[model samples]
Target: MRRELPGLGSDPASVRQRIEGMEQILERMFVVPGINKPVGLDVILSLIPGVGTISAAALGSYIAWEARNLGMSKWQVARMAGNIGFDMLLGAIPVIGAIPDFFFRSNTRNLRIVRKHLDKKHPGSRTLDVQATPGA
Candidate 1:
């Protein structure tokens, strides 16, 4: 007799998988395709007038919620939100924004933030604690 949890329900792995998928979308589709010439879905979809960037940002925001479930700190969530905000704001600035989107991927940055925190909290993962040093 066990009560089921809410979001995660019964699988921690699914949460991890989802985060990984989002990271891939950010890295492969949004960032790397431009340099490598593979032509990702994100970039192709971004050809639309306004729907492209907005939809991508909405999709990326889910990672922030997932990061919270994974025990990420408020600062981490803020960083994720900031990344998405910048992606959206700058993404609206015509050609300049479009060019940056092909390189300066905020979703990837957010994913890295979540992964860094997860690895810190979970056992058997990389334990790199980031702390302020003396006289920096």
Candidate 2:
């Protein structure tokens, strides 16, 4: 089994970094020219036939799971799960889901929750870094 993150429940800096890295990849890894909006692996992956939507949704769940690991409240975790669920539901549809996927940005939404909760609970943990790389 994969090892639990060190100090995940009590100290979340390292865990936050790891989760933020993942959210960065999943939510906003690329920019649209001129329009300047960003997109990422989750949106790209959902465009694939079969497997893709499910995979993106599964990967999206990791943030919520990590939040639970950090001892976030059940309500907070449930909210995170709901965001992922909405993304997944929209993503499961072909063609129509694309625009919503671009706008909804559920991974980023969930990361904000994690950050908010961490800021309240962990106190000293650095702010969550969800910004996509420039020109990516």
Candidate 3:
């Protein structure tokens, strides 16, 4: 039989780490030339022909689910949902939508909320940035 451990993966700090992982992939995986900021799978996926925004939003919902598990308030959770909603709604608009997706960065915004909640409730532990490749 396999056993799960406490204060490990399921704990608040671990949750923050996990959130960072998701945010790293979805929001900061790459860099654009000239502007010199990171971009991630969220924007790349948004560029897909169809079902892209939905798929990204679905992945985003996982963060909200994690927040609920972390005991965040209904308001905070709703705000996070609101962020995703805006991202998806705008992201659905085609060319113009993709442009905004490049800048909206909803995952980063949501992660900020999740990390703030964890940092407040679980003192001493700090939110850490996910490792990323250097952008050109």
Please report, in order, the local distance difference test score of every candidate based on alpha carbons: 0.67, 0.83, 0.83
| Candidate 3 per-residue C-alpha lDDT over 108-130 given as tens digits, one digit per residue, 9 for 90 to 100 | 89998988887788975584444
lDDT of 1 by residue, 5-107 (tens): 5434424455666776776665464334455433344444355557877877788788888888877789989999999888777667654567666666777
Which lDDT tens digits does candidate 2 get at residues 6-110?
Answer: 645345887788688889899878778999887888989878755788899899998888889888889999999999999988888886677788889899999
lDDT of 3: 0.83
Greater-TM-score candidate between 2 and 3: 3
Question: How does candidate 1 score on lDDT?
Answer: 0.67
* Backbone N/Cα/C clashes per model: 0, 0, 0
Of the two candidates 1 and 2, the one with more favorable lDDT, higher being better, is 2
What's the best-to-worst order under TM-score? 3, 2, 1
Off by over 4 Å in 3: 1-8, 128-136
